[model samples]
Target: MAAKRPVDRPRPTLLIILAAALTLLTLQFRGLQPLDAFQQGVRDIVEPVRSLSDRLTDPVQTAWNGVFGFEALRLENERLEVELARMRGNALTSEADTELLNRLLSEVDIAYSDFDAVVVRILGQPPGNFSSHMIEVDKGTDDGIEEGMAVVTGAGLVGRLEQVDRSRSLVQLATHPDFRVGVRLVTSQDEGLAKGTGTEGILRIESGVRLDAQVDNDEVLVTSGGRSLFPGDIPVGKVLDPDSDADYRRSIIIGLAADLENLSFLKVVLPAEKPEGMR
Candidate 1:
């Protein structure tokens, strides 16, 4: 017997597949209702598998998204923080500008409103043993600021311009030991000399009111303007106490009206021609 020969099995031709696809397409285009039912049946069989696959992968996709989204959330938070800080800075600047404008307006409304004056910002405090006794202002002789000119704030007297340069002037604070101003009691109509005690925000009255004169606590003191240093009626301070002896001469302590520690803006009274009929 001869060895058995292998026979080749027949495979479907490409033409047969093309014919089958064309048949399905033609049936579908012709609105064949049976083809639609057959397609729906196939989809129903595949739908359960797809739904199960999505359920199996859902937690893993969620965890992956959370891991990546955390960084995105962190970056967003940092951006917001920077924006908030910028807004806060702008708010502070606006508040400061408003305060400065109000202060300048108030200072302009004082007794020197009609007088020629210059508004100067305090540049620094001079350095030395008298550092506490004086502050530096941004105005100088070039701006018509001169020594002996009085410095004042909206509240009251701050000091007198002492050393003046071309662009800056030093203010001798009224609290300096040698500082003196003629003051009059508002209530008693008595005049007195107020002297600084080398202490901050304090003054001592001397050589004006006699011991027999009536002086009371909390009495307001204003400049007498006798010596041409300060304008008359500028507030000096309030009387704290009276000190009198057998000589019938009295001295009193004064609490300053201006808050020296927080001085920022001031007015320098310029020398002007004395008005007719005015001292």
Candidate 2:
């Protein structure tokens, strides 16, 4: 007889698994005490591992959230800084504009009240040879400004309008070498011709008063309106010294009332016949 052939063992099947799971479920449903004890043992073995996994992941989740939050905060801070810079720039601009407006209004109210005058912006210094002695203004014939009109500031006379265009004018500052005005000493009976020296902050008074006249230091000078070049009583300057030099014995040095180097706004006094209006 040939050796008996070995029989193959059958593999476990899905039907067997289904039957086992159904039997456990039925026992638990019937409240079998032994099944409850087995379920409790499974939970006790798995619960600690589940809790350890949750604890490990919690810190990592928190760190990740913190990194993203830091980035968000950085972006928000940058946005706020940009907005603040823009607002600061706007505030500075508004303050500058308000200050300029107040200054212009004060010029109108205080200085040019005696005559119909045009308030003009000093555009800039004139170009080339005239730059040191003259400035350009933004109003001209169209604004009723004309050559020879007196230009002044709140402080006192600045110059006369030298040239006029349709919409612009040139001013010859009072310090020009060719400029001259009649002036009188406020404290003394001395009358003189106040003349520009073509130099900054200096004027020459060639008076007919005797050299021995008591013209003290800091004596005020005012326009005499002799030739009608300027109105009477406008403050010109205060005496600085009576030069005793051989060539300038009758002359004295004085400081100007108006600050020419920092001129900003001007008023052009209209001719006596021109009607009052603003540009």
Could you list the CA RMSD of all candidates, in the order they appear? 37.3, 39.2
Q: Least lDDT summed over 10 consecutive residues: which range in candidate 1?
A: 104-113
1-279: candidate 2 lDDT, tens digit per residue:
856546633345566878899999998899898886675466446545645865698798679868877887788789879979987879978687546534543443323356767899886765567477888887767777667778888767788888776666789888999888887776674788888899987888876656777887766666666576676666677788866543536878878878886577888876555546633
Provide the overall lDDT of each model, using Cα atoms, as 2-decimal numbers: 0.75, 0.73
Compared with the true structure, what per-residue lDDT tens digits does model 1 show for residues 191-212? 8788889888899987878788
Candidate closest to the true structure, highest lDDT = 1
lDDT (Cα, 0-100) at 180 in candidate 2: 82
Error of 1 at 48 (Å): 87
Candidate 1 is scored at a TM of 0.56
- The lDDT of model 1 is 0.75
Name the lDDT value of residue 74 in candidate 1.
Answer: 86
